[model samples]
Structures are given as structure tokens and as C-alpha cells.
Target: MTGRIHRTAAGLGPAAPVRAVHLGLGGFHRSHQAWYTAGDPEWGIAAYTFRNTELPRALTEQQGVYTLLVAGEEAEVVGSLSRAHAGADRESWLADLASPDVAVLTLTVTEAAYAVPEPGQDSAVQRVVAGLRARHRSGGAPITVVPCDNVPDNGAVLRSVLRSATRDDRRFAAWVEEQVSVVSTVVDRITPAPTDEDVAAALRATGLRDEAPVRTEPFTEWLLAGDFPAGRPAWERRGARFVPDVGVYQQRKLWFLNGAHSLLAYAGLARGHTTIREAVDDDALAGTVQQWWDTAARHIALDPAEVAEYCRRLRDRFAAPGIRHQLRQIATDGSQKIPARWLPVLRAERAAGRLPGAVVTGLAAWLLHLRGGEVRDPRAAELVESAGSVRRALLALDEEVGADDELVSAVEAELHRT
Candidate 1:
């Protein structure tokens, strides 16, 4: 901790009413949404950390103000969040939801959080259902729930989950149907967890100790498509785009950016590279990423020039020297990630009767990664046990891909190449 202290109120005016409540308060939210919200003084966010008490405690101690360190660029204190709480704070969470002022609810919880989540289980959807129930009972003011997770059709997915969660109560379900809008979003930013050096540098630069400083690449984007019934901040003024549809943009990100990232994570780890920059610096792995992007681009419906430029920018972002995005970190939760990042494209290519080499290679690398050592995944036991069967792994991930012999053979051949 540094000697100097800069309170949130010092830089920004009196704490604004909470107009947004965010789930999964991590570095990405700070670097992306909170940074955009900082552009508008009238909006303040009540952010909740995902299962971590330390971050919320630290942010609370700092008066919900922290430093944003743009890797190899600049550092600035962000004051958009007015409150921070542990995810388990039911009273505070319910109160915030019941408040009529909160018009937008954003989430950065990962994909697995929304899958068959039991009520009151550490599930993002469960928490949202509880909040929405509270809001519905308390005047049922309309709110837009924006999912910032990197899943395709995230808005619809969330709505489906909410529907299932509240299916027992027809009144609550009806209220949700009438009063809530789920917004699909395309959010991009390479926000790596800050290193000890980053913390020291922030202290040197600002003369204040920021326990929860976020370090991210300079590139950032947020595209939202949906209604905000209770209104929202002018986030568009701060680089966020409100488009009519985010499908093309979402596919571009999911396939090109996130798909390439998954490829690098598995393949790079297999090659002993730790960070994304090191992986991209390796000629073979970088070529593999490029190949994956080329194959992925075939499926996106965006303008050719835009897709090309997006791919070009993706290469630059991946090669950022200052960003130490760890491949191991990306490799975690591969079971949940691969379905969205790889399977859709792989299935589409297979349906077109063309076996995608890059997709096969990525799948093989992930299988090889499973064979490498113990991994952190919910389905780790099944993955380890099914190492010999590509069909088993694919089926375990999604039953829809049921024993596709041709696809299995392609993945096996690629696995042998590894």
C-alpha cells in the first residue's frame, strides 16, 4: 500500500444513484464497462465480485475507486463504481434490485454459470432471478439485463435460463416477460490479471496503493443490441456502440478473437509457451492462429473488408508485447469454452462437407492438453477418462455431436500429428 490516498468522491462528485447493478465484478468489467460508464457522471454501478471476498472488500475499502493501467500505455483512476459487495450479500443485492433507479444489469460471469444453475447456488442466473423477483415484487420497474459473457446468443441464452428458473411461478415468469429486456452484447478486451510489478508501478505512478488495479490491452469494444426500458447512460459517447443487431459482430469475436485465443491456449501450452505474446511470437503457433482465423472467417456474414480489418487488428492485439495474458489462464474451463468457440464452426464446416484443418488441429491440441496433466475443469475426470475417444469428448461436451465418426477420425489424425 502506498502513502497517498485518493477517495472516489475526490475525483468524481457526490456518489450518483445506482443506475446499474453488475454481476461478476472482475478486471474485464473494470477495464470495459466501468471505464465506459466513467464517461457519464450521472451513472454509478454497484458491482459484485464473483465468489471472491477479497476484491469486494478491497474495492469497498477504496470507496469503489481503483486504477486502470493500460498496459504499455497509461494509468488512470476510474470512479464509476459507487459500491462493491460480495456476491453472497443477499440483502444489499435485493435492495439494489428493488430500487427503481437501476435500469441496467450487466454480467461478466462465464458461460458455465448459466447452465442448469440451481437457485441460490453460486450461479449468475440464479442471482439474477432472485434480483428480478425482488424487483418484480417491488413495483416491477423495467430493466435491461445485458450479458457481457462471450457466448453466442447470450441474451437469448440468459432469457431461457431465467425462464426455466422461474417456471414454477407463473406470475414471476409473466412479470419477467413483461418488464425485462435481455440485451445481447459483444465485448472485447484482453484484461489480464495485474502482476505484482503492475501494482508497484501503479503505486509509483499514482502514489496510492490500488489493491485491485486492472491491467489490460488498450483495445476495447462493447456492442449492445436491445432495449433499455428504464433508460441508460450515454455509453455510446465513450466508444460503446448500440447497433440494431450484434450477430455479425458477435460471430466475428467468438470465432476470430476467442477462437484464436482457444487455439493458442491449447497449442501454445503444448509447445511450452505461457503467455499469448510468447505464443504469437512463435512462428508455428502464430501460423496456426492465422489458419484458424482464415477458416473461421468463412462462416461470418460481416463485410469482407470489415472482417479482414478485424482479423488484422486481432493479430495485433494477440501480439501485444505489454500484455501478459497467460495461456494457462485461458486454458482453464476448456470444457465450457470449446463448445462455443470451436464446435459451432467445426459443425458448420463439417456440414459443408469440408473438414477444417485448423479447427481439427485446435481440437487435437485441446485433447493433447487434457493428456498433458491435471487440469482445472468441472469435467476433468470425464475428459481424462475419455482421452482415447474423440467421440466421447465431443459427446461429453455436447450430446448433439453424437458419435460423428468422420469428425472423430479427423480430430484423431490431428491428435496424432501433435
Candidate 2:
């Protein structure tokens, strides 16, 4: 059968449904959340990119439609998004939030965007508070805010930020605390940035070029533990789990999967591998990742059975032949990722009087990569400016470094040596 593409209001067809709002309008959002919404038109998403008008412009031009190619080990499962739009229409984006049709507010603001204020804040949370306050003043119904960043206490962090910003505004804050629902979530999907060639291939697959095509692995998971303030997608109907606790799930993904991904990102970049598939295919680096996962696994609280299952899924996803997820992309924002991804496990190891060797090595690689000496990922330059001296960075971030000597020495020693 010849592959063909279609454009509709929602992206797939005119009859496709729409609802919901997402903040970070990026490729991963398209492949994962939008793809899920497309599976069931009843849940369409209104999305806005952060500080950039590019995605909104392209998406608008494409008629708010794009292809979702679920590239597997070799094949692809293609779909379309009909309900997505760039925040080029800010009024429209907020209107949906104020409308009865949109209930859930999902975010993919990446780690850095969440770093509004310094160590504590110089009114850092004010912006988020103002945003929410405006939405509240918009006279909209209550809404649930789900943050998909890698922050440990994501919902609490965002809520605190919002509250701190609005603390002076008693009336608005009270309304928010009572009416808004903040949901903590753990999202896993190794969707990579598509290269020029990959974009060409996606277009070739459909015999039509799409300006905003997204490529991702077949695996995806969303674990939530909070109330949907106003309401939410029947995401559970599509395999999204609303668990009583997302802590174990969060740790499992953060410490092992993300930890290992970070390790390989720096280590692999030092070895000159560009994409994740290339890094995993390298036996030495893949072995390092497995070893890191092994060491980090001991700290996670999930059932050993589920932990093993997650590892299998991660391996398959990383091995995805068609997804060219760049190592550099994952390697971005180490300053923010280190605290949430590596520091907690190190603290746990110290508390238990155990040495997390794999995690230590991963940290060492990050330190080395951040020191601006080994890794070739140019983006690392600006991302880890604080890495020049871990001591100052940690102190500045107010991060409790339990294994001070070991951690610092490990990272410093590997700085030039590694």
C-alpha cells in the first residue's frame, strides 16, 4: 500500500476531537502525548512552546497537523496529531485553559525552564504564579497541572513556586490552593531530536514533507499521583497509570534509566558517538550503562520484577534503530539534572555506608564532561559553566553533599584523567 498523509482540524481528519493544554510544545510532546491523544480524539491538546515562536509557526502553517512516526528497531508506526498548535495563539491557548473543554494542563518545560529563581528564589516562582493567577482570574474552572520535568518533587516544586509567587496575593492563592490540583508525574519515552536526514526520511515515508514531523521509540509510560483539579484525559484508558505513589517509579526512572543515560551521554560523547543508538551499539559504553543501572538499581524501592521489566524496555528503546536521539540533547542541563538524577542516589549510598560505584563513575563522567575538556558535545559548554568548581555550584544550589570527599575527588580526579 502506498503511504499517504492527510491534514485535518485536529491533524488527522476533520472529525478528530480536541481538548487539554500542554506547555512545552516540542518533538517529544508531539510523539508521546499528542500521539496518545490522536489514538482517541476525545482528548485533543492545545500546546505552547517556551519563549520560541518557531514550533507554533510551523504547526500553524501545517494546519495544526503533523505526523507521529513510531520508529521501531527497523519499521515505523505512523499517526497524526489534529489537536496541536503552537502558543503563537496565546489568547487561544489560555482560552482553552479557561474553557470547559480543557481540564488538564500538562507541561514539558524541560529542566532549565523550571529554574526560575536562584538557590531559593528572588521571586522566582512569581512568573508561574502570575501565569496561574491570570488563568484563575480568567474565570476558568479548576485545572490539574502535571509537570513532566525530571524534578524529584515536581508537583510540589511547581506548586510551591506558584504559592510563593502568589503568597502576597491572599485571595488568589487561597482560590488556587482550594481549586487547583497539582499532579506529580513520571514520564518515560526516549524520543530524540530528529536530524535533517531523519526528517527527510519521515517525509519520504509519507511521500509528503511535513515541517514538524517527530520520531520516537515505541515505548512510553506515564505514572501520576495526584488529583486532576478540574479533570483530565481518560489517559488510563490508554495505559496511563494513576498510582497512589509515584516515588518508587520516579526513582527507578531517574536513578537508573536517567542516571545511565547521563553517564552514557558524557562518556559516549567523549568517545565521539553522536546519537544514543550509536552509543548503545558500542559494546564498551553499553556495558558501562548496564553496570551503572545495576549499581543504581539497589537504591530504587520498586519490586525487583518491575525494575527488571523497566530495564528491558529501556534497552529496547535505546536500541531503536530508527530513532536518532542525539547524545548531546540528553546531555544538556547537567547543572539541573545532577541534583535530581545523581545526587539523591549518592546520598542514599552514603546513608547506608555503601559506595555506588556505577553512579560515582557516571558523576565522574559528568564532572569531566562539564569541566570543558573531554566531551565533544558543544552545547555542554554553556550548560555546565558551574562545573569548573563543583564546590561552589553545589553550595550555590544549596544541595547537601553527604559524600563530599569521595564525590568531589571522584569528579575532580576524572576531570582531566578520564
| Clash numbers, per candidate | 0, 5
**C-alpha lDDT score of every prediction, in listed order:** 0.86, 0.69
Model 2: colliding residue pairs: 10-82, 10-83, 11-82, 19-44, 56-86
TM agreement with the true structure for every prediction: 0.95, 0.86
Give a tens-digit lDDT track for model 1, residues 1-418.
3453346433556566799999989989999999999899899999997679998998888888888888778788888999999977989999998899999999998877767675457677778888999999899999999999988889988888888888899999999988999999999999987688877877876878878888888899999999998999889988999999899888888888988998999999988899999999999988888888778878878788898899889888988777899998888888888888888888888889988888777888888888888687878998888866788877887776647777788888877777
Question: How many Å off is the CA of 285 in candidate 1?
Answer: 1.0
Q: What lDDT, from 0 to 1, does candidate 1 have? A: 0.86
The model with the greatest TM-score is 1
Task: Give, for candidate 2, the lowest lDDT window spanning 10 residues.
Answer: 73-82
**What would the per-residue lDDT of candidate 2 be over residues 1-418, giving only the tens digit for each residue?**
4333336322345534445777777877876666665566566666776556776776666666666667754323323334455445556665666676567777887776564464443231433454566677788468788888888878888887776656677888898898788888898887777667765766666666666777777778888999875666676666888899888778888887788788788788878898888888999888878876776777777777888887888888788677777778888877677678877777778888876666656666666566655444324554366666866544443346622776666656655566
Candidate 1 minimal-lDDT segment of 10 residues = 1-10
